[model samples]
Target: MLDLERRLRGSKQRLLFIALASVCILIVLLNIGVLSDAPGIKSTIIKVPLRGDRPYDTIPFPTSDGSDFEGSYQPEDAHPIAGLMKEADEKWRKYEESRSKTFRETVAKYREKHGRHPPPGFKEWYKFARERNVHNIDDFEQIMDDLRPFWAIDPKVIRKMAAKLQENPDDGIAGIHIRDNKVVNLTNPSWRSETLAGLISRFVKYLPDMDIAVNRLDQSRVVVPFEDLQELLATEQGSRKMKSDARDGFTKNMGHFLNFEEPTGDWDNETNPEWFPYPGRQYMDIAKLACPPESPARNENLTVEDADALYKHQLGGLVTNFNLSTDLCTVGPAIQDQHGFLYSASSMIASKRLVPVFSECKVNVNNDILFPANMYILKDPRYVYDKTYDYEWEDKADTLIWRGVTSGGVQVEDNWQRMHRQRLVMLTNSTLMSDQEVKILTESFEEKGKYENFSHFEPSVFAKKHFDVGFTDAWGCIPGDCPFYKDIWTFKEAVTLSEQFKDKFLVDVDGHSFSGRWRAFLFSKSLGIKATIFREWHDSRLFAWRHFIPLDNRYDDLYSIMTYLIGTGFKTNPADNYANNNNVYVRKHDFEGKMIAMQGRNWAQRVLRDEDIEIYMLRLLLEYGRIIDDNRDEIGYSGDGSELDDFDKKHPMPESPPHLNWNTI
Candidate 1:
């Protein structure tokens, strides 16, 4: 039994040992796997594989909120940060409220002071405040400070006042008092006299019944009678002198004023009913008395037949001197048969003769014949100065000077009237001639006749024809002789007139078109037909060599003519190369294209050129073009370069040919 018990104990001990060894081996394997795979595993031993497929070292632990530790972890909110954020929000809200309150108060205050709502800038309100009393920013600021605590006054009012005061310190004005009585007398003499007279007159005329008083000695007393005071004023030498000299040297000339006397009959008589009579009537009476006696009637001694003969002889002399033809006799019936004058009293004076005889009749006729001649006298010298004269006489004498002989025993003061009459006859004779006669006269005039008074004659007779040939030329009929009348002719009309004489006149010479003096004369006989054509078409020829030829060749001439035209206010379009070259042309991409081209060419040619003027003109063209383009749409025109482009394309750019120098272009 002991042996069997020993065997059982031994078997049990062995089984226990085997079990402990197996456990030890498992622990060792786990330790080796965990410790060997992971680096720096010091404190705790973990299993080789964690939950699911994650490695022990890679899997993160759960945080307190049951989220991933890396993502959920956050630092605690510090007291300083939270406190600062709250403080900022509170400050911002308070600031906004304060600003809004300030703005509202300012607006309200401005409205109250100005009697109307303030403008957005409070400009008027500030001006008013400155004008009242607020003089400087300090004053304004002080007022604002005083009113800041009050709800009634606006802070903005103070601010605006402060700003205005800062801007203008002496803007206010106070009513001034004159303490010294002598100060009034010491005032500007003319102003004081005028003011005093005006005051007295106004009281006399407007407030006749009202008492007039003055604090001369600072005592209030009933006013004296205005009439009595006026009498005293009239008697006072100083007052009378002032009144007499009121017109300066004007009233001193007694030739202009009239004297009047009290009425002899019952003053209120129905027939006369005169207080004194109109000053104008008194003037007429004075004028009648002042006028020199008329000469004794020399024509009265002669019979009507003798008078007719004398008149005919005088007319024949005038006609002969003026070179008037027999055709003028055809209108003889329309003319007057007066003993002295050429035209009848009722005759419609043609413009050709009106200028001359009007002056003659004005000076010659007495009151009996003056009735008809009075219609010819222009009331104002300005009318004669402006209407009757051309631009040539603008700088000449104010009154026209004339020199000539007179007939009909008419004693002339100045020979101006006679000379004026002669001029009229000459002008009339010139206009009334036939085409052939005109040609002959014009030739004769050019050849033998020296220019008498026609200082404004142009090289071409077109100007003469334009001024003369009244009924035949439509341009002559334009009111005021406006230059714009020529613009009324259509391009077609101009083209027709051009074509009519193109073969005869517009002949090409030396590869260039030119209308000589003779051809131009014939064309001008009608109505400036040749001038119109040349001005429109061949006008470009004036600047032809500018584009294709070197500027140096004719630069001086080109520059002079261009400057002249520009100075004279000639209209030039950039597209119209015929009227003007591309000198003033402007382009969008190249604003100073022409100037640049000019400068470049000048530099290439080694010519000293006016860069300033070239650049200035370029800038002017660019600016003008921009202004025109901007307003074109409103002006019922397309802003696109259509018109300019079309014209430009038709006139091709001159190409540089062969080995020619580019400096010319």
Candidate 2:
């Protein structure tokens, strides 16, 4: 009950079901005379739903994704973007305030979340964070969620499994070891190896001696089937009995350097025989197994329905529940063709069994543990944002700009048009997607409020006027199909990071994996319009609409979002003209755009800093340490923490001010 409650509390889902269920249970008991002195009482009261059942099968958000609408506005903001902003700001504020402030609270929070004491050396981990001035201490929940099922497997079995994985160089994974407070890099120097070593070195001395296996490839590796994953989790969490020899401290010198004392799993302890590996082909069907039985990605028909739902616009198609929007389980089937990973990841080496792997980023259903990307940590000049070389939102051109090679997944000539980078470029530069219409929020000349009209638009003209999107290179496609790409796409000269900074809106999308350029984009003085299927460590800290605009993976909401910020040029008597003439009424919302741009820039500085990266790594390592310990059930940091101050609790951080009152009147 406590574990379920903790999960629900952390989720955006409601907890009102508990109270409603309880009341209905009481009424039923009374009606049956189980709680009454009288014998024949057949009266009933309030009915309620069971915990197993949910009213809304899909995302609980009421606002439409603008997929089923073809009508005028209700004398109000035609787009739900304004309402989205309000809800986003409110959600972020509540989450920020809900973070545990002090040591006692942090320990209490850990217990509340896991229903167990903090692992041994947790105090040391806390001290390491406090000494380095770490802020968000209680946000290490992902580590637990990743490591929980492993608790069902014996610690010896886990150590042996990791050792075996490390032995298989063909597995495309590297070994990370910690000994006497130093990260031992036992692999050849590479970007991932160096970055992992550098990140761990920041506070490796604080972590216990343990062996870690990290995916060497850029792509995610492990993906347990939903049913199997559920069983693993339930078994792990249900068995709480401690071994007779279990102690309350970590084993001394537990890092075995690839030499496990126990026999290999193939002998006495056989590994899961169901670990199927897809070499290098389409893995969408295989990947879909990770989603729940009900998600759209799990079925062919549901996926088609989801695909059509992209703009099927009811109350105006706008993004809400940014997290849910990024969920790969629900999103993959809808926009699989638009993503490379779905159709063909460059390295499709994968597993359907549980394996601990530290990765840079992953989609929601993927089980890989996330770490800070090397692009952000390395501070490469190619991806860095230098304010001295950049323009402010007000000083820059009022246009959204994007420039990148086509690298989402391995693409081919036939599939080139479906890939995200290619599709985005096509949507802006040509009329491949839309013959002439662009979904937009504009003034309703008919009678009142803002109007959401699928207005006529020229992609080339819109690109020339409001966007600077193009492909710098046509790579990713098969060599045999490479010649056909140039026929379809007109490649432009590649621009530098500073060159892109000239635009007021930066568009970031997924590449072969998660875009590493997001951090750089956020640091700039421009509103970031990002659409991605991957989730990263910074996801919990970043709020869409408040910091950045979140776009759906399908990108059907593209024109609508663009028009909301930079209006259609339908100014002079739009009622009569209907924007049919070349008279583009170019109405701009510079204030709103600049507001979000500055907010994103400011927030990135505080939470996405290098120090914060180190803090997160340290916290993740601490949790990982407990999972691999022989006395995992017994060992824990036992401290009352009576001496901690509650400054944040007493006076919480002030929330961002309310939405600006636009003087439309």
Candidate 3:
């Protein structure tokens, strides 16, 4: 029996040991899991590879092989005189260069002797001539002589060149025809009226007839009307009287205002103190307080409506009245006065709710006045007014004497005083409350009454909608201060929320103002959403359609009337399609359809036009010049190729067809 009992005890002990081991294992596993998931435990480090490459080198200039100036050569069969002149021009240039040294030396000596300055009266003229490299007086005279003959060249050639350059200047070589005293070699694959105008203005001095044929130097032989050249020049010169006619039309369209006035009595008699006892006297003082001398007695005879009207009129007058003593430039004093006026108006309005004396007086507190003033006072505690000014007495002695007479001053009693008296009477009339009831009713009401939540209360029904969307209504009476100011945020939120809700909400762009910043934020927050922003005041239709089309990703459908041009189909030459200005092809369609087609067509025309080409070339030159001007420090090259180096570094060589290698084909 003793042996069996001992065995049973051993078995029980083994079971207890097993249970202890299991608890230990579970605790260890729990700790390991917790520690592994801890935020502080970092897993591994990462190293990203960096890829570096060298910057690009400047491209070299292209070599010329008559191919560069291919289209510029006059055909052997056409214009025999032009071909002869070209040969003669080459010979003349060589001869002129050989003889130029002596002339240059003589001119330098004369300039040095003259002290390198123009003779006094010629300063302006000298400055103007020097800009065009006319350093010597003789060169200036030559330029003036060139301008004197208007019809020296065929106006046709001048117009054609202008039109061509207006279209695309890259198509041909630009040169001055010395014999004809005209500009030539305008080649544009595209042509536009504005481009033509620019060309005409550039070379208006040489009036060429409008029938010259404009040809592309390449394989494409594109030809266009010279009439475009003539009309463009005429329009540019304003010789067509468009400006004068426009002014006349504007004057005729203007609506005139009629002069009228109401009859009035003599000011002195009407304002006489005897006839009009009050005259300009206001019921409220300039400080917006009740007038001291008239207040208590005036309240007796004035009706509530009359008193309200008088107070409003006086408050408005005080606001509008300019104090000459204060410098108008000082906003500090003006803001102070504004705050004082607002406080007084609020106090009077609050008082009116009690007495009904100022019932009709409506002082509109708008959003701008509320938020800005609240923010100002919050930022600077000193903005609050605590003290009043004493303007009546000269000294303490005078004030004491004045107070002595007013000690028993008549007090203005009203119905508001009676209401307060009745509140106590009602409480007394109720059955006596136990301690628990008093705690529940009185203490609870004091802690959680309507007034306790005044801060969160929407000032009015209309204000609730605006406040929720982020706008204040404290200065509602002021222009640009009402809930309308929130139209921008409202519109943006509507559009954004609509997308998120999937057609549950829609913003009327026409109905509300849209702020760009808010719209940007909304669009950024939503993953697959876009909103159209429309300008409120200027060209609303254009702005709306443009914004909407872009948002819808319809790039091809949108068109700007300002940039519209005629299509390329009407041109006789197929190469004209490539001309910058000449390529606009106007098709028969609705305005909207025409606008869309005009976009790409105009771009093609501009490339083909000659005058457009010249302007574009000049623009490229200007851009290169600006770059050189801005980055003068980085300009560097090796050795004595430095004469033009310094000059070119300071003023980059103009980008031209020769320098640009523009035509790879």
lDDT tens per residue, model 2, 227-283: 988998898778654343434467676643464445334513334323455633666
Candidate 3 wrong stretches, greater than 4 Å: 1-471, 474-476, 479-514, 518-522, 525-665
Which RMSD values do the candidates have, in order?
43.1, 20.4, 36.0
- TM-scores for all candidates? 0.14, 0.80, 0.13
Residue 17's lDDT in candidate 3: 97
Better of 1 and 3 by lDDT: 3
lDDT for model 3: 0.22
lDDT tens digits by residue: candidate 3, 1-665: 99999999999999999999999898677666555757764323222224211000122111111112222222111111222233333532343343211223323433443222111112222223223322122322211111112122232223223222322244232212111223333323223222333443453432321212222121111111223324433443342111111110001111111111322222232121111111112213322221223333223444433433331112111111111111111111122222222112211211110000001011111000000011111222222211122111111010000000000011112211112111111112212111111100011123321111111111122112111121112231223233333322222122222222221111111001122121211121111111221121111111121111121111111111111111112335645332332323322112221212222122222222233223322222221121112121222111122233343244332121211111222
Off by over 4 Å in 2: 1-78, 240-249, 255-257, 260-280, 299-313, 430-435, 573-587, 643-665
Say which candidate scores most in TM-score.
Answer: 2
lDDT of 1 by residue, 35-75 (tens): 57566554255344544332113223322111231221111
Off by over 4 Å in 1: 1-432, 435-665
* Candidate 1 global TM-score: 0.14
- Report residue 606 deviation for candidate 2 (angstroms): 1.5
Give the whole-model CA lDDT for all candidates, comma-separated: 0.21, 0.68, 0.22
